[model samples]
Target: MDVSIILILLLAGTLVTLFSGKAAGKVALAFGLLALGASVALLTKFNAHQNIGCLGVWMENPQIYFALNGDGLSLAMVLLTTSLLPIIMYSTFGSEVKNPSSFYALILFMGFAMVGTFLAADGFLYYIFWELALIPIYFIALNWGNGDAKERQKAVVKFFIYTFAGSLFMLASFAYLYTKAGNFLIGNLSALSLSADEQFWIFLGFFAAYAIKIPLIPFHTWQAAVYQKAPTAGTMLLSGIMLKMGLYSVLRWQLPIAPYAAKTFMTIFIVFGIAGTIYGSIVALRQKDLKKLLAYSSLAHVGLIAAGAYTLTVDGLRGAVLQMISHGFVIVGLFFAAEVIFRRYQTREISEMGGIRVQAPKFTSMFMILVLASVALPSTFNFVGEFTVLYGLSSINIWFPILGGLTIILGAYYMLKMFQNVMLGEANPKPFADITFQEGLTMGVIIAVLFFFGLYPKPIVDMITPSIEQILSYTHKL
Candidate 1:
């Protein structure tokens, strides 16, 4: 099957999940597996030099196409999305969602939009997929979110407005690109020539959207709130896969399409990225809520990843991809850890958790491994990305790496402290039960991916290098 099959399967999943009655969760799970299976097959075909892609004209007047191609870079992201869907679904197996049909459908629909965002090769079509992704999550967080109904609505709306407004800038940017090139295909737009002023404004417009989406520092106001209120699955999708949409766009859309603008303002954006790293780490140290703390921690990591990307070196870009994939799993694992705790303790506040490690050795072990990975412990997959990114930054400026590297120390400080508080402090009066088998399995899959990739990053590194180099050739105007 072609890459379009992935989109088709997910879209089909959404519809089937919606009308499947009480078996929606199972239907969603089956479709998630089918999507995952489809992506794996594509990856196999991709490695064997088969063109696992589909292209068709969606509109003749505006020069748009329903294009989906699987280069190493795009395929890696597709794998991330497909791999996480089933995991996210499984992560919630122990909990009962009210209106399960709608809940599961929203998740599948969100997956559909996100996968499209990754696979879309046409600029306007990409923007459409990008915007389509926001709808399901808005409903997910608004309707199924925790906390007071009014408060959930408020947070979800804030998130939607901030993201929606940011996307307008992107839309405007694409409109300009269309005028210049008269086509929205990635190849045409990436090769389109424009004046410095034009590239600058276009770059800024894309940056506004990407920054808000990746949520680098000042643009990050909506993140923690929505994370805190959304259900765990929504949080997983947002942090794990949705945010990568921005980082991926940086290499795919921002850098290549406006090479001169990217080269000129690289430092400014790098500074923004590094600043977010430090700022997010600092803020995370103060969050009383577990999910909110993980949210900020995610901000810190993505900031570093973004900073690495703007370095514009092969190492920087490749490291960003590696980090993005690793971060996707690590962040999901961390948030799910929070979910596991919440399920057992009935509270997300750090103060309300303690001494669970004594009762739940299996869960504690997996959570601890995830914590270490977040801090970029040696030999973990995270270390590979973090070290590569820091190396890339160092090639530019010693202080760039120094500043960006702060996420490591700061992350360890806050994460370990949070872990200690949640799992290792004095025993609480309430009895704590160990994780169920399904929950253990969920965390186990995540931990296994982190370590396996950590030890053998060469496969991923080799796979994505050509695509990253092709992108850099554009940025370097070679």
Candidate 2:
């Protein structure tokens, strides 16, 4: 598994997809299939004990390396990104975009940036990819987004400034760490010693970046608007894969680099996360616009994932990783469902939709499965992750789990309400079409993966546990 191939293929996909003109979606899907093949090869070749690389010595004086590697943690994320790319492209096959070429090109480029972020083993390389990931999405939203021109501009610009500013803080912190350690390798940074106060400051700097990316609580003002305005593909990128970058950063960078600070402020971070969970759920309950509702729902779920990370226990960390994957699949499916409804009715308001189930039972059934998964029903993938996270929270303190558990009740209430408004009740008088074959393929694939993992999660649990344990050991040693 030459890690470089994944990046090259994605970049090539971007160019080929762009040049393919009106068939850009098909071109992108072809490239995505190729990339998935490469990722599968990488997964088979990956050895958790050794850092695999096709290139090295990217810089001299700074001693940076182009050494792309895949531990279990990174490979899982890379697989997720590659797996979703084709589905996302396939979902767009029937649409007439303003510029199909550029639209699909940006999506492919976004995939490259995200894969780079996951596989990057050097600190500076990680930052480069982190900032690079933001660029494509910004353009996607700014150029192709829905709603008023001025409003979309404001939302995209605000998202840009917010994430870019946060990245600067992260860069500053990394620079300080570089000066102290004289290198930018992740291993070196993790091994460096810092005083409690220094660790606290570094932690704060990283927190600003991750929090904004995760968009926890007060820092989340940019998310709902940006998510609502971005074109569905762009929004899928943001919610499905992008948010996990922040949560993944916590496990990969923040906790290990600033162990004392992580330990010292664990309670505060958990409390803030719980607050975001409650706040997001409550706000979602009132949202009339379906996109905004899912956006807020994402906020709530991610908050719980972040809180689980702060728990610093095996169950918590594993649950966070598992839930990240679950949320990625389920949320993408849900948003795609939203787009399906919008395509038929040309409206995103819940009040405007009714009795879709009567007209499109296949679509309705799939949507119901995803909705139930989101609400964490038993025998579904989300249930396993949520249960583990709750168990982790309970291990820390009973009240923490108790408070976070409100998500179960709130999740069911809001999700069921949204489903009832959009899919049930008296049938709409307007003619409605059943799910198209392409749409069914997309939804069917996602639903199948969700069900498979729900019943047998041991494979993923086995792959990620060692990396999570390694992270825990490093934090504990400090």
Candidate 3:
């Protein structure tokens, strides 16, 4: 009931906002706040030791349960999703984005799908919500995206087809599991006994979807163009939260169901993830477009996160979740900064930008802080997560940490280079305005979280540690 309330509020907000016409953005913000309130209520109940909520037999012949269970992991993700919605909505205030009603409505719907994905306990229900998320984002990108029509169309289509095709493999795996377990419940699927061969195929099936979504190395070709073409809001949804869905699925679905296969192929997955870390960093260093640069930066960060999870160590899983949350906040802030830049300077090319600090010191300062965080500065939230991940990788092999840690140097190099080129040069003749009050609030909230967690990460680490232990226990038994 508590979790469902969040979804109901969002879906209801979607309808209300659609009907709100010109006032849709305001309505959307209001609903986002309400949903955030519900999220708070859920957390409160969780703290007070109350049942969060669960409703089963809610869907099809195969059957899917609608659950709002607030385990540590789910609660953390719920909080991330709800909190980001209002901030994301607020970032759009006073802007003219064609049909404001539809745009805001899609944002709410996208939140609904993500929350559902986080809370779902039934495999079929999880799959449904997972695919449901793609719909809103697809339309969001297809309609609101900025670029040449042909380019936008190509990017959106490729993104859509790539993700959808990957999902079919997951669906097939779920069907096979249903046959083996006689139900679609996650518990049953995780507990079902299977041979090494069976586990290998199942793991591969899940990996297909996850790899495409995470877009690890060879699978990531579609991401840069799609991110560059999409509007800033759409880019945030994709980079900030949507991509995490893939990484989260690896923890929630892949490892548990196919522990043997996961163990068997652990090195393969880790190598790919580390390869992506190095590969994405190299690509990012060369990007002319700021959005594309950040997109590749995101890829590199998530690569390390993925590598952490594949380690199957408690520290690795813990680090992965922490990084997911931290990355979500940081990436959104960075993308918003990019949007703010685009709004002011009318270009995303790093070559065309310079002396922003002279013109807009406030913007430069905030952007610099975010960049520092992304580079895992010692006092930032990312530092804790990145350090933990490197530590986790080290357990597998000292070399693993050594290789994966390249991201830190590469990240700082590209990030500082971009910042120097864009924010620290001679002032452009045209007046470049500093961040407005709204932009400041958005970036400020994110920075505050990063700082707070960076200094004192024990609360989140404590909350998620037991859950990480539970997951690691499953892997150990296998």
Candidate 4:
């Protein structure tokens, strides 16, 4: 089957589902499953060693190319995209969203753009999809948000402008590189020789874009508000999958292409990452809103991932990738749990919730497991990822890991405190309900994945190692 056909099928399905009305949920699910299967087939047929250019043309001076190419890295991201969509669609079934057709359409379209971002070999083409992915999400947040109209609009707009500003700098960086390389293909740009001065400026542009997206401290202001304001499904998608795009790009574009600059300025990057981790944890400890707290905690976790990635070791890269996957699952479960609590209490404030576990043992149990995972407790996926990252950081500097390790303490403090306030405190006078079948199933799947991969993470580590090797090889050549 043609890859283009797969893309078309997804695009067409989203369009068709927009007109499906109430049945849109079912239609979207069917299309998502089909897309997932087709993606798997495409993976099997993909030639990892060869470049698959789609179409190209000559510009005024430089040549322009539009293409889809897959190597280990792009394929891994594509797999992540396809694997998550069906689950997200399934999770949405439990949601009480209005205008289901438009909601599903936006989600499917977002999936299409995410896959395109991973597959596009040309820098300009990739940028187009990078920006395109944000559009559906903006609408998703605006249309489906839970907060008051003004607050939701403000959050969505803030997210949009912050990310867009960073993207523009990224575009400028790529244009500069294109002038020197005379080609827009990532491989060609990676091969081009660049001076340290040039690499420094280019790296800045790339870092600005990625930092805001992954949203390491300072730049993370937009996230908690947006997460709190957006609907549950939108929050899941944003935290669970969309944030990975930034981290993935850091690996795909920044490291390999500007190795010397990265190496020279490594300390600054590591410092920023560590600062974000500590700062995020400290702030999360104070948040009253459950979703906002989880959002800040996620910021802290991904900051550690970023620090590990910059360590430039095999273990560091592998751990970062694994953590990306693990965090995605853990955060989805966390946000889903938050949704359940909100449905019962009609509020996300922890102080307003209590005795929830009395009537909702199953819900409480699942929430506890997810919280443990988020806090990096032993025998969970978070533990495996966090341990590996620390080990990776240890090789760079004992102090780096030592300072970064503070997150574990802070993470536990806030997480357990939130749990104690919401679950262990005296029962509130208001009535509470037990967990629903759908909610239980969603959390069960996430918890099972957490433990399964935590106990045995070698498979994903091995799969990702080859791509890390390929990326690191470019750095060595530099």
Candidate 5:
């Protein structure tokens, strides 16, 4: 029941899929399900109060360990990562991917890295997994992406350089922390006593990485292009799961290690997040490209999620976690719908797509749920997350929720506008095919999860509350 088993399954899936030739996609899906199953089994045991973590020294001098733990917080993320990988893989079933082996391998390997990033309890080891997750995505986007080659290359390169560069700051921060704490374990680093100035620089160092990875406001320049360029799976991985790495790191590493600075700097970062929310929603309204619209939509969602986390309140942290899980599913479904439309029409342009509903009733049904969920309509999982987040913001100030709530209003306008343009009206007569069983299955799974969680969020809410409280304890020290 060790949490490392999830990483092992993903790595094995990668190796097996790499040699699987034409069957690589199927192999990836099978392995992905296994990892998902593993995470679920571990979850049951976890609630039963069993140890599902492992530790061993990986390096002597720097004192790093092959430490992996599944606190409820980490497991929540691991569940998100594991659950999405199969759907992401299966979403590509209808595409004619060149070099399926390498492509599927990269997908599995990226999952391996992300699972490791979530579970790694040692700081140095976590960085290793974090950076490793970047490599596969870079190649996935650069090689397998849509659009003009030169343009896609530029976007992917910018993403690579931006993320890798930001990570260096995190690495530097970790190095400094190691010097003071003498070990890179989470407990040790979070326990360090540092001067306010030390905490400030350290906080900024981590913030530099997280803000870019989260792509909050000014640092978000790289996201739209990359999302538009990447293949659907790559896009899903980026928006659904990878985006959470930075948000999770804020909870796991950044704040606890630099509590005083987190408290001191909270106001400014919260403003940054809320601004991104407003900016992204407005931009989404303007997007002509479906993927770009969804990209900006995701930017809006994560912006609010980031703002909630920075609030450092129980409501804030809880809402952020819930939103992260729901957003992971919703974004993947939105991108998959985009990819489905593109497969039929050979274009990402919203203007070029219409009347899909007249043709594909199943697709229209599922996609409509996704659209409403994105707008946080009641009884959708997203509604719960968004309401919780807004409640957190309102707890802080009438103004926080007032500004952040604009995401919902603006989000609904843009999302429904895009949906009406793309899915409604006259059937384009270009012969739109209904989604295949495989595609329908993926969308159905996502919609089901959203509805189920929307109705019953208590399980996850309970799971993460203890961990969130622990984090607040650290932040409250200021």
Candidate 6:
């Protein structure tokens, strides 16, 4: 079966959804399931040894080849994207969306772009899909967001402009590489050599783009506002899946293609990652809003993943990939829990709620599990990633891992504080309800996966190790 069919199905689903009102959810769900199944089949058929293929030539330049290829790395991301879409769609059931068709249509369209981002082999094609993924969510957030209309619009615009500015630098970096390699294919570019100075500038351009997308410290001002204001489903997609694109691109494009510069500037880059970790955690500690706190915490977690990738060890790379997956689940569960609380109380302020656990034991229990996972508790998926990442960093610099380890304490402090304020303190004057069956089921699945993978992470480790090995081999050659 042609992989292009996946894109076609998504486009078709979007169109069908826009016209069909009540049937929109069913259509979107069916398409999402089919896409997931197809992605699994593709993964099953994938050959780890084969990493490149051309679907056709898109332009006169041989560089602009239309291609779809996957090795272990791409397969992992593809599987992750496909698997999560169905769950995200399911979570949107009976949401407050009035234009359900358009809402579902945008989701289907976004899925197409995300799948393409993971699969596209040419630099130019990849950029197109990369930018394409942002549009649907921009509209989704602007249209469906909570809060004053002016504030939501401002937040969405800020998010769009910041990310787009970063993307421009990314395009410039790709163009610079294309000038030398005369090809846009990622594989060919990885084989090309550049002087240290040239490599440094190119790396900076790539880093600028990725850092903003990852929203590392100083680049992160727009994120918390957007997350706090955006609709819950939109926020889920943004934090859960969209953020991974930045970390993944660092592995795919920056580290492999510019090893000399990466080696030269590794410390500086790692410093930024560490800064983001500490800054995000400290700011989160001060936030009174639950969603904003989770937003800041997400920033801190991704910083660790970004730092792990910059370490350039197999363990670092593998941990970064695994953590990306783990963080996705943890953030989704966290925000969903926030949504449950907000729906019951019509508020996100931490101080307004108290003694929630006393009234809602099931919700509190689920929330506690997610908080533990976020804090990288023993036997959680987050712990596996964090441990490997720190171990990998220890090989680079003794002090680096020591500072990075501080996140464990900071993470626990902020997460537990938020949990206690919402769940453990004295009961609120206004009553709140317990979790709904749908909400419980959604969170339960996420926590179960977190526990399963946390305790037995060997399978993911095995799947990602080969790809990390391949990346490391490329760096060694350079």
Local accuracy by lDDT, each model? 0.91, 0.91, 0.89, 0.86, 0.92, 0.86
Q: Highest lDDT among the candidates is held by which one? A: 5
- TM-score of each candidate structure, all chains considered together: 0.98, 0.98, 0.98, 0.95, 0.98, 0.96
**Model 6, C-alpha of 254: deviation from truth (Å):** 0.9
With candidate 6 superimposed using the best TM-score fit, by how many Å does residue 353's alpha carbon deviate from the native?
0.8
Clash statistics: count for each candidate: 0, 0, 0, 0, 0, 0
Instruction: Tell me the lDDT of model 3 at 201.
Output: 92
Q: RMSD to native for every prediction?
A: 1.2, 1.1, 1.4, 2.1, 1.1, 1.6
Off by over 4 Å in 5: 48-51
lDDT of 6 by residue, 229-303 (tens): 999888998899888888888998888888898887888888888888888888899999999999999998888
Candidate 3 TM-score, true structure as reference: 0.98
Which candidate, 1 or 4, would have the higher lDDT against the true structure?
1
Candidate 4, residue 68: lDDT = 79
lDDT of 3: 0.89
Name the runs in model 2 displaced over 4 angstroms.
none
**Candidate 3 Cα outliers beyond 4 Å, as residue runs:** 47-51
Q: What tens-digit string does per-residue lDDT give for candidate 5 at 338-420?
A: 88888899998888888999899989989999999999989989999889988998877889999999999999899999989
- lDDT (tens digit, per residue) of candidate 3 on 252-334: 88989999899998999999999999999999999999999999999999999999999999888899999999999999999
* TM-score: the better of candidates 2 and 4: 2
- What is the C-alpha local distance difference test score of candidate 1? 0.91
